[model samples]
Target: MAGEDEIEGRNREDEQMHYNSTNLSSDWPFNATNDLTNTSMAMVASSNPMNNASCSSASMIDSFCQTPPTIWDHHPTNSQTLGAFSDLNMQNNPTTSSSSLGFRKGNLLTPSWPPPNSAIKRGGMFLPPPTATPTMLPHTLSQFPADSGFIERAARLSSFSAGNFEDMINPFGNVPESSMSPYNNRPVQGQPQEGFVNGFKSTSGEGSKDLPLPVDCGTNDGSQPKNDARQGGSGFSGNNLPGESEYSEGGAGGGGGQDETSDEGLGSKKRRRSDQDSDYNQVKRSPQTPNESTKNNTEIQQKGDKNPISVANKSKHGKQISQSSDGQKEEYIHVRARRGQATNSHSLAERVRREKISERMKFLQDLVPGCSKVTGKAVMLDEIINYVQSLQRQVEFLSMKLATVNPRMDFNIEGLLAKDMGVSGTLGFGADMAMAYTQNPSQLAIMQGGIPGLGSSSSDAVRRTINSHLMAIGGVYKDPNSQVPNSWDDELHNIVQMGLNPSSTQNLGSTTPSHLKAEP
Candidate 1:
C-alpha cells in the first residue's frame, strides 16, 4: 500500500515537471518536438514502479530538467515539417517577447510584412503602425506537414512585399539616369563606367594652371582695374591690336571684323594716338623711286582703264588718297572715324541700311514727275508723302469718272490716238479730219460752207454748234488770218477734189452728185 502511495506521489511530481518543462520550452525559442520528447521521457520514468522505488526516476527527471533548451531543435522530423513550424512561429511572434534573451523594443526578429495601403497619403508615404499583433498559428501540433502550395504562396507574398517596400523606400533606384535631372550625379545609361570626367581635374599636363583664369575685367562700382592706367585706360589692351586703320576702313566698307577700342582712354593716350597718325601720314607722303612709281602708275592706269566705274564707286564710298611713304607713293583709303566714342556693330549696320534706303529713295525721286526736288531728308519725305496722297486722290477721281462713263461706247481714247498717228492712206481723211478738229474747231466751220451735198450741209450745221459749245468752255482757236493757205486750204481742196472726182468714185454709180464736181 505504501509503494502504491509513493508511486502516485512520483507520478504527480513527474507530471508537474513535464508541465513546467513544456511551458519553459514554449516560452523559449526552441521547437515543440523537443518539449514533446521531454514530456514523453518524464511520463515513461514516472510510469515505471521499479525506478520510483530505486530513485532512478528522480535522477532521470533531474537530468531532463537540467538539459538546456536550444533555439531550434534537431528533431528526427522532416526538414519541410520543421521549416513550416518555424515559419508559423515566426508569423505568430514577429517580435521577440520580453522574456526572450536579446529582446528589445523596436527590434525585429523576423522579416517584416508590408504595411497596409492606408499608410500612404498625398505624395509621401506615412509611417507604419508602431506595433502590430502577428497572426498566431497552431502550437499544439508537434509536427507540421509541408504544403507546397502554401509554401509557394508565402514565398510569393514575401517577395512581393519585399519588392514593394524597397520601391517605397528608394523609388528612383530602378529609374533610368537619363530621365533624372542634369544636376543629379547619377550615371547615364549606355555610358562606360570609367569614362566619367571630373570637372575639378584638368585634362592638360599643367592641370589647373593650364586653365584660363578669370581676370577682374571691371567692377560695377565704377572702379577700374589697377593695370588699366598702364594699358592707356583700356580694360584690355588686346582689343586695339588690329590697329586704327582696320577700324577706319571697316567702318567705310560697312564690313564686320572691326575691333572697337575702349573709349575710356586718358589724354596721354590721345596724344599717342595723334602721334601714330602723324607718323602714318609722314610715311605715306614720302616720294617713291622713279621705277617703282612708274610701275605703280602703270598698274593703276591698267586697273582704272579696265573698270573706270569700279574706281569711281570706291572713291564715292571712301576717299583713296595717294601718299608718298619711305620714298614710295602709296594710296591710303581714308574713312570717317568715330574717335574714342563707343560704337555698336548694330549701329554700323543700321547706318549702312539707311544709306541703301537713301539711294533707293533718290532713284524713286528721279522717276516721280514733279516731286519737289529736295536735299533735306525731312523735306524729301514730306514731298514723297504728299505725292503718294495726291496719286491716291487721282486714282479715286479716275475710278469715279470711269464708273460714270457710258459702258455702251466701244470707243477707246488710246486706240483713237494710235490709229490717228499710224497710217495716212485709206483712213487718212478720217484721221486728218479728227486732228484738224482737235487742233482748231474754227477750221471745221470754214470747211462746212464749202460742202455741196445736203448731208454735207447738215454736217456743217452740227460742226458749227459743236464749235460754239467748245468755244464757250474756253477752247483755244487759231486766228483765221494766221492760217497759211498752203497748210489748210491746199489739204482741204485735195480732200474735196478726191471726194468729188467721177473717176475716183467709179463704184458710186449714177447716185453721185454733179454739184460736187471738182474745179481742176
Candidate 2:
C-alpha cells in the first residue's frame, strides 16, 4: 500500500512540473498563440498519464480550471478568472499563474505582437517582417536629383569676371565661346549667317502682304547709286541701297531654285529649326556693324522687290524726292501763272519789281495828304513831289519867323511853340514880335521880309547871320507909323488872309510871295 502511495505522488509531481514547463514555453518566440500552446500541452499530459489516481485528480482539477487568455485577445480575459486561479497557483508555482505571465497589466494594455525580427504566417500567406515606426526629417536640396547641364552652366556663370560683362550682355550676335561652340557652322560676329541669308531669300519671293511698304531713305551723299552684279544674282540691281544687292541676289536665286525644284518633283525648301538653330538664335542677339545693318536692311527690302509695279513706283517716288531736294537749294519763287499772264523769267522779274515799287508808293501816299486816292503811278509821283516842296517852303518860312521872333537866340523855342501863336488878329504878329524883341535891330530884316531868295537853305544862313548882329537899338520907335510901314501892313494883312484860307495850301507857288505867306 505504501508503494502505491509513492507512485501516485511521483505522478502528481510530474503533472505539476509539466504544467509549469508548458506555461513558460507559451511566452517563447516559437509559440503560435497561448491557446494553441496550452491545447498541445494538455494533449501531451493526457497521453503520458502514468497513474490512474494521479490522472483522476488532474482530470478533476482540469474540469474546475478555465482557459487562459491568448495573445490575440485585444482585451485580456477578465482579471476575476486570473484572481480565482491566482490563489490556487500562487503558493506553489507563481510562473504557471496566468496573471503573472500572459495577463500582466502592462502586457495586456500595450501588447506588442509578432516581434520585429519575426514573420507572421497566417493561413497560406506569410506577412513581411514588422517594421519600426517611421520618423520625419528636414528637407534639403541635396535630397533631389542633380542636373549636369544646369550645374555646369551655373559653374561657368560664377566663373565670369567683370571684364567679360560686355560679352555676356552683347546683343549683336557676339556670343560667348562656350555658348557658340556647340552650334556648328554658325557665322562669325561681323559676318552674315548663311541660314539667315537663305531664309531671307526664301521669304523674299513670298510677298509680305501684311507688312507696310518701306520708306526710301536715300544715301547721305547725293551721288547716283551704282549696281553691284554680285549682289543681284539675276543681274538686275536698279537703285538698290548699299547692302540690298545681296538681298536681290538671294531672292533671284531662291525663286529660280524653288521653281526648278517644284518642276522636278523635289521637296519644298522649308526647314524646321533644330535645337542647335534655336540656341544659335538665342546667342545671335548681339550688336552688328554697319555692313551687317546694310545686309539686314537688304533682307527687309527684298520682299518688296518681287512686285515690279512697286519697284517702279519706288523709283518714281525717289526721282520726285531728288527733284524736290535739288529745288530746295536753288533760289526761285514758286509762282503759278494765270491763264492770261506770262510765265517767262523776264516777265516774272518785271512783275516782282513792279510789286515792290507799288508797295513803296502806297507807303509814300500815306505820308502825303490827298494822294491816297491817286491810282496812276505818274500822278502819285507828281503829288508826292508837290507835297515835299510845300513842306520845304513851310520849314524855310518857319525858320525865318523864328529868327525874327527870337533875336537873342537864347529864348526857349520849345516853350514858345507850346503856347498858342494867336495870329488871327491884325496886330497879332506885331504884338508877338514886339513882346519877343527888346528893341533889337537884328529882327528888322525879318519883319520887313528883306531876306534874299537864296533857296531852301537861305533861312539857316540868315539865322546864323542874325546871330552875329547883337547890337541893341536904344530907343523904341514912338511913332506907331514908323514901327511898321503902310505897305508892310498891307502885305502882312494879305499874307495873313491867305494863310487863314485852307485852300491856299494847294499851290504854294501861287502869285502871292511865298516867304511872306504864312503856312496854311
Top-TM-score candidate index: 1
Poorest 10 consecutive residues by lDDT, candidate 1 = 122-131
Candidate 1 yields a Cα-based lDDT of 0.25
Q: What's the TM for model 1? A: 0.21
Clashes of each: 7, 7
Query: What is the per-residue lDDT of model 2 for residues 1-520, given as tens digits with 9 covering 90 to 100?
Result: 2222222223322322332233223223323342343333333323432233223323333333221111112111211222233332111111111111222111111213222111111100000000000000001111222223322322332222221222222321232222221111111110111111211111111101100000000111101000000111111111111113222332323222221111000111100112322343343333332343323323322321211111112233323322432232121112322323443335645777888899998999999999999989899999999999999999999998978878754333321221112121111345444334325444433432321222223434433332222111112222323433444455444445433223222222231233223222
Q: What digit string (tens of lDDT, one per residue) describes model 1 on residues 364-441?
A: 788666654677778777888888889999999998887776353233322222222111111123435545544654
Model 1 misplacement above 4 A: 1-342, 368-375, 406-408, 411-520
lDDT (0 to 1) per candidate? 0.25, 0.26
